[model samples]
Target: MPSPFILSGCSGGGKSSVLDELKDRGFTVVPEAGRRVVADALQTNSNALPWIDPLAFCRACCDLHMQDLAKLPNQERRVFLDRSLIDLFAYLEMKRISVPADLGAALRAVSYAKTVFLTPPWQQIFVNDQERKASFKEAALEYEHLLSSYRSLGYQVTLLPKTSVADRTDMLLNELDQMDA
Candidate 1:
């Protein structure tokens, strides 16, 4: 399986936009699991929400992420993932929820690209939606947690510039090109 290149950071930090841009540029991409999980819960009126039951919510997100990872085709091309399994741990930390041992083990087992692209808190582009309810302050805190989590896992975290989507995509593609070189 191709090792995924992860774009992870605070919600509303334009990670999704970057993923979209990458997709447009013909790269395989994985959508954020948490957004899909939350949207499904809301649609089904389930209690698996972050604010309602963070553990359950995180578990669902992780399951989705694992499923997505399992479906990735084995190839040489790099797949761009909006987030990875480690994001669950970061979310649990930010929410002050206990991280399950199984979750930790899973995080240790799963692998991605050695370098992760991290989008810092961009207040100008940050906004709340149905799936993203975290305030800018909360988002910033989450960004810090993600930074720590990814670094602790020994992945090199490259901070994406707080710039336009096109500029960010150009920067990311350029970095990937250098990696290929």
Candidate 2:
């Protein structure tokens, strides 16, 4: 199976918007695991949130990502994911928390496409929401850490240009097409 293309980067960036456009275009798109984890924890009134318990949050998100990867069934079609296990490693490093052995193993075993798209931090677009609470500064820090992490892992990290959502989406699709060619 072909490796999935991942869209991961600064919080509050336009990653979600591009993913929405991709989904609307009928391509397979995996939502961000962190958002899903937060949504689930909120439903159960659990404190397993990023701000409450980051390690637990990372574990939950890792589990969700693994499950989603196992369930996704496309041998030839392109798949785009908002984030993956790689983010877990970066997050742990950022928090100065040691990664568990199991997580470390998964991070090594799982891989995405060599080229990963990252939404760079845009101050004007950053905002705190119920799910995304990180400030722009924090998001930028996370983005830098994640970029370094991916590069160290041997993926070509592509920064999505700061532009309108439509243009960004078009750029992603066009580049993906070119990559396929």
Candidate 3:
């Protein structure tokens, strides 16, 4: 399968908002795995939550992300992934946890566009939701980790300008159009 374009950054930095806008415009987008794992855990009253069992939570995200990728059409579909398996790997590294063997193999099995659109941390737009409980400070730290990790993995980081969602969406589309050319 062809690689996807990923939107990733700090947890609450509006990656989802941009993806929402793209979806509104009828573009194909993959949901973030972390949020889905958290929501599922909460619904099932499972202890695989980040606060309770972080390693398990990370593994769950990896599994879900892989599943999400599996559902993609095996072609250059121009799919935009909201975060990715690498983001789960970044989270593991940030927490100083060792990556499981299956996780490494899974990472090797897939690829994404070399350029990743990263939303910078903006305290003004950050909010504390039930799924995302990280404080702004913590989220900023996570952003640093994601930036470092993506660079280490040879992905070019494109920081999304801090602006209204509409502007961000337009900028992203322009980039995608260039990539298409």
Off by over 4 Å in 1: none
Write one digit per residue (lDDT tens) for candidate 1, span 18-92: 999899888889999999999999999988899899998988988899899889888877799989888888888
lDDT of each: 0.90, 0.89, 0.88
* 10 residues in a row with least lDDT, candidate 3: 70-79
Stretches > 4 Å off in candidate 2: none
TM-score for every candidate vs. truth? 0.96, 0.95, 0.95
Q: Sort all candidates by lDDT, best to worst.
A: 1, 2, 3
Model 1 superposed RMSD (Cα): 1.1
lDDT of 2 by residue, 92-167 (tens): 8999999999898877777688989999999988888888888889999999999999999888888889999889
TM-score of 2: 0.95
TM-score-wise, the better of 1 and 2 is 1
- On lDDT, who's better, 2 or 3? 2
Question: What is the per-residue lDDT of model 3 for residues 1-181, given as tens digits with 9 covering 90 to 100?
Answer: 5678999998789999999999888778999888889999999999879889988898898888889888987765577999988887778887888989988998999888898999999988999988998889989988998999899999988899999999999998898788779
Which of the numbered candidates is closest to the native, going by highest TM-score?
A: 1
Q: What is the lDDT of residue 174 in candidate 1?
A: 91
